[model samples]
Target: MFTVTPEAQKEVSVFFEGKEVQPIRIFIHGGGCGGPMVAMALDEEKDNDVRFDIGGIPYVVEKDLFEAGKPFEVAFNGMGFAVNSSLQLEAGGGGCSGCSSSGSCGC
Candidate 1:
């Protein structure tokens, strides 16, 4: 299932306040020091996508990814949207062995 909070809906609404709106695509973003994260971006629908419409906004996630990350939710945190899901990633898949907290690893 896919869900989006009212606050998150408003946040996206405000972003498109004066422009044409596009569907928000949820997908695997990157595998950095923190690991691969689910992220959102403006995109069009695709043949393999699963779509959800919430609060007048459309969200789409690839079919396989939607199944892997079942029961996804989007909520507005203080600063921005936070995506929660049941998807699991392998530990240390991105390998941060020598990375430091001083932004040296570009985390």
Candidate 2:
């Protein structure tokens, strides 16, 4: 059940506007060194793909990926869109460790 938040639905419409509309394809992206990641792209339907509709938006995912990534959700982060999965992908920490101006870390 890949779901799209309301704000994401709007963004989706805007993103594909004036372009050829295709079902949003969701799949797990193996980052290897970085970690397992989920990604989305516009893709043509495949023979083994499963289709689902969320908020009137259609999406397709490979059967196995769908089983693994059920209950997925798409949301708009401040900078861009992000795919949130039940599988947690932890971030590599340690940011803003460098010296800062004034008394605050810019980050």
Query: Which has the greatest lDDT?
Result: 1
Worst 10 residues of 1 by lDDT: 90-99
Mind giving the per-residue lDDT tens digits that candidate 2 earns over 40-72? 888888889998877556788888877776778
Clashing pairs in 1: none
Deviation (Å) of 51 in candidate 1:
0.8
For model 2 the local lDDT of residue 84 reads: 81
Off by more than 4 A, model 2: 88-107
lDDT of 1 by residue, 14-90 (tens): 99898887899998877677677788999999999999988778899999999999999999987878888999866
Model 1 spans with C-alpha error above 4 angstroms: 91-99, 103-106
Clashes of each: 0, 0
